[model samples]
Target: MSNLPENSFFESLKAEDLSGVAYKNHLLKKKVLNYFSNFGNSTIQDLSKALNISTPKMGQIILELTENGVVQDYGKVDSSVGRRPNQYGLNASSAFFVGIEVKKEYINLGLTDFKNQLLKFLPHIPYNLDNTEEALDELCKIINQQIDKFNVPKSKIIGIGINLSGRINYKTGYSYSYFNFSENPLSKVFRTKTGFPTFLENDSRAMAFGEFKGGGIVKEEKNVLFINVGYGIGMGIMINGELVYGKSGFSGEIGHIPLFENEIICHCGKKGCLETEASGRALISKFYKKLQEGSQSTLSHRIKSENDLKLNDIINAALNDDVLAIELIDEIGKKLGRGISALLHLYNPELVIIGGSLAKTGDYLFLPIKMAINKYSLSLVSNDSKIVLSELGEKAGALGACQLVRKRLLQSE
Candidate 1:
């Protein structure tokens, strides 16, 4: 522990041993802990078979985790065998984590247990970039308030995870693309303001982390891609179960990927980026443009203002059989699919998860995206990859943020 870095819990875990035997034992323990943590209580045979390990080895790892207070034995399971197997589960009360998802308009915050359950969810607070100090102060106050409300002890709170929509240096907890304040380092500022260790990550990457930890996608496959479509589009790439943040921590800026050969300007100061043609903003812009041109649609009469055209509005209208909204979403979905097709060719990920606000459109969005992939992507790649909507939905980022802290705690132990 003395040799490990003070700022990282996982570093301490890694510092324990460098030998092959020790490494294998650590991995075995991790596998067992992860299985129980995710699948709830299970018997030794259940875990051994699920993890493809022998009963003796699995028992040894379970014993180690139990010693570390990471796992607890409940009672004996009445099985038709020589003896009843003891049931084991992760200690849900072992620790807690704070998750924060930062958007341009507001910040979503929540407190989660080791099982990633949202013990407390706070209302979204409007974020003002101009008043950085005030914003940070308010954020800290809310976090403290939530912790107090939950009656969680300070020692049990491992760290705070902040998810943002920009390039982030995960190692340094610095966001270069967003939060460009001069005097304060956002991570340090928040940590100082709240007195909690903090971890920062890209919003889409956080979504990926949440989805990965939440389960469903194949575990053996390492390459996974998450496409987040909201006011804008972003992507998170996980290769070998690790986030692929290229040089400068901006690897998954898929929205800025030049797709269309047009002159529509993007928020990133570029023209013809995928977001300009396919994002929620793009859909809203297109809707407004159509309305101005006197296009006949129910939305034209329903939406009095541009801001009134929410992603949910479009989705609901479409679900209610609004021809105009359906048509608009369909067009945007096609563009989004084309963008995803590019990802398929580039990454060849085993699973591609679509998440964010617009994902509520559900089948309306998935169909067009799949169609576009079929049309544009190589047949082999398209055949090998599966595209599905995220199960965590809007809470993915926040949940993933909490998982970050949980992972840090586990790694440190």
Candidate 2:
């Protein structure tokens, strides 16, 4: 084993010396760390079998990782063998990750250990996306509060990861779509305020990463499309285990994909975009229109203000068998399905995951989306793909944001 310092991981990335024997050692350690991170607790034999490496090689990797403070011996597994093998798991205290999800109405802050387990989650913090100063202050306060709770050393906190619902340049850490900052860069501002490295990623991409890492999407099935339906619809595409960021990291802007010939202009100033017909905002808007048009429904009696009608409220009404709510969501689901069909034609992904706020509708959302796919998509592509609801629910974005930090900052370091 080399006498390299434990900080070599971070130093190597910053110094750009991740080559030769050091690189190989890094890869081996990362593999071991990833396995333990995924499986929780496992023995050297278990790792060898899982990775198809010889016991001796696996032992060497494990020993090196243990020495580097990346892996820790948890205890012995009670096996009916001569002696129970010692189990190993990631040292969660070794590193920390901070993730923030920026939404229209609020911002969410989360703290996770290197293993991606949630240490703390601060949801629905009052953050007006248009208010730069107030939003920044609120964000900083919540992050500092969480950090204090964890009692982690500043050095252990690798970086802050941010997930937003608009175009973001992950490489430059600049958000061209959401948030307003002049003179000072957002990432630099956050880093200076918090004393940690920072990263910014699109919310959909972050959700896809979360699903890929922990949401039961197998590593071998690398190509996946995650569709997020919230205030608006968006997509995150992963091809060959890498995010399909187009020329400007906006490759998966499926929400703006034209699905209808109608003349409703989208937020992107386009007509007939899928989001104008399928998103939660679209559904709620249409529901209000119908209500005002004297459409008979239980919702009309309950909704005093158009703004009072939330996506979850509509879903609940639909679940309770409200005729108008059910019909409205069913229509939205069908529109979503049509958008997904277009996605199938373009990406031909192995899996299509429906995520975000509307995911709570479950079968009400999925069944109709599936029906639309069956109606619109080609048999070959639809047959090869599986459309499933996200298992992580609303936490996918925050979890994925944390994962972005791990992938970009911690692991590379």
Candidate 3:
């Protein structure tokens, strides 16, 4: 394999191929890279102390990383005393990770550097998402096209993370909800077609990871629940600072929770799922029904047909203080809050983040959720959880996908 960090130290590459010493060194190098990724620039002594390695050994690893163009010298740290220690950090150009979010109506693509900083984000690429072979093919084609247009070489693209909805076993690289036409894993197909190491993640989990690492949560907040109120409601649960993936890696199916009494059948073919009333799809359905009932809204004419309407249009309308838009969002929020009350009773998370497309409605959505939580949940449990909107908003899923690639790559065996 090439000595470049992009090619040599990928997660797909087997560490068993390396000798014991080489494997240990590889593990240490990965630790160093992750340190730089999390803490940004650091002095050699600081790295040695934090990573629990001797200064000389740390120096050796740093030297190897620098030689491989993975770590770059960032001159000396500021100090009052003479002979300040030199700072080192990841070479931003060393490798790139791509994150792709496949939504019901469109795709979001993003690129992150070795430091896990988003370098580019392509939102709203028109594509229909479905559980069909042709849909998967078109998705792969769009991903490849987007990557090709990026100002990075194919070899330098170390990994790709594709986020999809429904039951996805990220470890097994299988998407149970979509692209299950063949026995082959969805990620395997993507890897073959995209010519890169690819991994599949649940969209809600990806969004939660994005918020956990990039946008939301302080260092103190470890337990979090990210409620993804997208086309369908999904959840990403974090407990004790680690994302919770159940035995089958299908942990966060909060949307399908049987919380309502309505006869509306969910996309999952169940009746009275939380998603039947508390999701973006639900929001659109309610808006259309209300419009047909002669409810007035400034956006009614703009949405002549169901196909012409979009989640964003409603969110934007709510943001502009449209009454009907706000009312429907509040209704969704109340139902979502009731569902979240159940989660709070179970998880007692330190934080609950409202994310996805509906998050754009802001206080129009947040206040009702807060009210509902207060009304439904026990004060002690609900009080511990801070309900807030997502800081990353629409970008969370794609950005989290990129973060997941780096995370899986550096995970110790």
Candidate 4:
């Protein structure tokens, strides 16, 4: 594939390599882009007033941007007094982004335009997460294949964001969990392999970004927690309108917190972890063990072995009113509530989003979670938080990945 547009303002924005008047101009152009990104169409007068630039200077930048095909005239703004001014907005086709969500069992890839609209979504590509070079190569290969399917020009595709589970230092582009054998940062390796600027993000945090920016659930709320109850429980924390990435970029590992007294071994090789009792893995384990002990369910005949069972199977069973499935999901929800109660005390988030496959169980899961939160946490603290399911659903991770790429390129002082 061809590389990103050479020596173009888009490339300069990514490189951040300019100085003196050129740098000031670049910053000004970026400010206009950012303004359009955040607030949509704007008149030259509106942009100049909002960005505190003179109308003549703003008009010059807008004209240059229009010539460069980065910004387009979006027609006249609605008005009743005197003449209506022409509005300008981002040219959605001017650039594209690719987002990949890597899971233990499958991968989700999505293509988004400059407008943050998902153009294509390809989910459940059979792939296993592992710590190996071949696995990483396979991932890149799949990414190339999926992007090829979209048929967007290589130069038009600005960057690729890949979301992985486990400890990821996004600033330095290093993943401690997978592909750590290489001396180079994983992001650099991906950039080299895929021939596009590549960024790495933690899956949960990326999902949180997706919700915060595009899920339409958050309007003015600044503090929120996204509970990712997938194969394992993970959390994406937002504080003061920013995603929290602690030292070493491993902040949101809420699953590893030892909140239980159980002897069950977690995937992290620890005992009494929240994941040991409350995650999808834990639910599946409990369900399988119950079946082995002669417990009956509607899915018993359908599932001949534990390996044949899927999270969707349990969700569908609960939706069909299977007693065993409902009971198990409720139990997991209660444990999850106990875990979230601690977060409420600590973060006091304005919203708590329940996400992942188990979240599909809806009220069968949320009702017990609410009950347990009311029972364990202080009323004052828990009352401040509103828990809801993710609006972006299974697509949040991929969509968030695309948004992160945009954020990195467009971030300004």
TM-score of each: 0.78, 0.81, 0.91, 0.94
The TM-score leader among the candidates is 4
Per-residue lDDT tens digits for candidate 1, residues 1-413, read 11223433233343544568877777677667667665689998889889899998888888877866667889898778788878999777766788988775667777887677777766456654333656656667766666667677666676789887867888777777765575666787677767777888889999898788755444666788999998889888889888788887888889998989998999889999999999988988888788878876767777777877766566677788877777888899999999898888888889999988788888888899888888998999899998889887767788889988777645523
Ranking by TM-score: 4, 3, 2, 1
Model 4: weakest 10-residue lDDT segment is 8-17
Residue ranges of candidate 2 with Cα displaced over 4 Å? 1-68, 73-89, 121-126, 151-155, 215-220, 296-305, 410-413
Q: Give per-candidate clash totals.
A: 3, 2, 0, 0
> Model 3, range 122-161, lDDT digits (tens) per residue?
9999999977878888998998889889998777788899
lDDT of each: 0.78, 0.80, 0.87, 0.90
Sort order, lDDT high to low: 4, 3, 2, 1
- In terms of lDDT, model 3 sits at 0.87
Question: lDDT score of model 1?
Answer: 0.78
| Top lDDT prediction, candidate number | 4
> Any idea what lDDT model 2 has?
0.80
Per-residue C-alpha lDDT of model 2 across residues 292-343, encoded as one tens digit per residue: 8888776677788887887767877887888888888888999899889988
RMSD per candidate (Å) reads 5.6, 5.0, 2.7, 2.0
